[model samples]
Target: MAFAWKAAGITYNRYLAIAARVVRRSLKEGPRLQAERRGEMDLRFAKWQNGKQGENKSLGEANASAMAEQAKAE
Candidate 1:
């Protein structure tokens, strides 16, 4: 029964229109959507760099203070 249906091309053009519409929609949205996504990633990276710099500065200060305390004790 399944082989008979396959021989008749039962599903050959079943979803052709739907597949075309999907392709068109993706072509329409691809560039603009990708640009927006890239912009979002750039903004996230900027924020991360800012936070990393702040943390590094804080750590440096803490280390310097600890070193100063050690020197005073010695």
Candidate 2:
């Protein structure tokens, strides 16, 4: 199966990561634990820059750190 987000350059893993974070923050104690488990998906990916592939990191850390860098850039 495919999702519209994928066509917008978003991966399924990233979509799930974002959803899991939201669910985790909104759920109650018992359900929160289960949602946190859903958030535990660790994934690796690569990026090309100037035709060279960059090293990989966990999906969450990669996106968070990238946002942090962009915030610093602005």
Candidate 3:
């Protein structure tokens, strides 16, 4: 059987994100705040070139800009 998210043309990551958001929204005040904190993406990444690592960058910032660029292109 085909998955509903696949039928909707969203990637698995996107589907999970949507489901998580729904679950978080269903929580009461205090627990909802904690659950939202858990959803935060505090990730760091670095580029590698010629066997060397570059300075670390915020993954959230990277993804935001990438999505922005893609929107502009589209």
Candidate 4:
């Protein structure tokens, strides 16, 4: 069986990119400022397999990268 998103034909990253865009657009200035800062916090995910944490890239970086990729594809 295919994954949920795969079955729907959208990758998880694409889903997240769309969601982030919608959320950012929905926020107003007061909360948007706080949210953007929260978004910029460098967070890393770690699973036991590699015994190493992932690189420190902010959500802003990921969002920017996704936007850049979409821009290039257009």
Best by TM-score: 3
Minimal lDDT window, size 10, model 2: 34-43
Clashing pairs in 4: none
After superposition, candidate 2 runs with Cα above 4 Å error? 1-35, 47-54
Better-scoring candidate (lDDT), 1 or 4: 4
Q: Can you write out model 4's per-residue Cα lDDT over 1-74, one digit (the tens) per residue?
A: 87777888998988876778679768999998777776654654433446766665666667789999999999
Model 4 stretches with alpha carbons more than 4 Å out: 1-9, 41-74
Between prediction 2 and prediction 3, which has the larger lDDT?
Answer: 3
**lDDT for 23 (candidate 2):** 71
Where is model 3 poorest over a 10-residue stretch in terms of lDDT?
A: 36-45
Better of 2 and 4 by lDDT: 2
lDDT of 1: 0.53
lDDT of each: 0.53, 0.82, 0.97, 0.75
Each prediction's TM-score versus the true structure: 0.24, 0.41, 0.79, 0.37
lDDT of 1 at 42: 18
Which candidate, 1 or 2, would have the higher lDDT against the true structure? 2
Best by lDDT: 3
Shift of residue 64 alpha carbon in model 3, Å: 2.8
For model 2, residues 1-74, the per-residue Cα lDDT tens digits are 65677877888878876776887889899999987876665778888899999987688888899999999999
Q: What is the C-alpha RMSD of each candidate to the true structure, in Å?
A: 20.9, 6.4, 2.1, 7.4
The parts of candidate 3 lying over 4 Å away from their true place are 67-74
The TM-score of candidate 3 is: 0.79
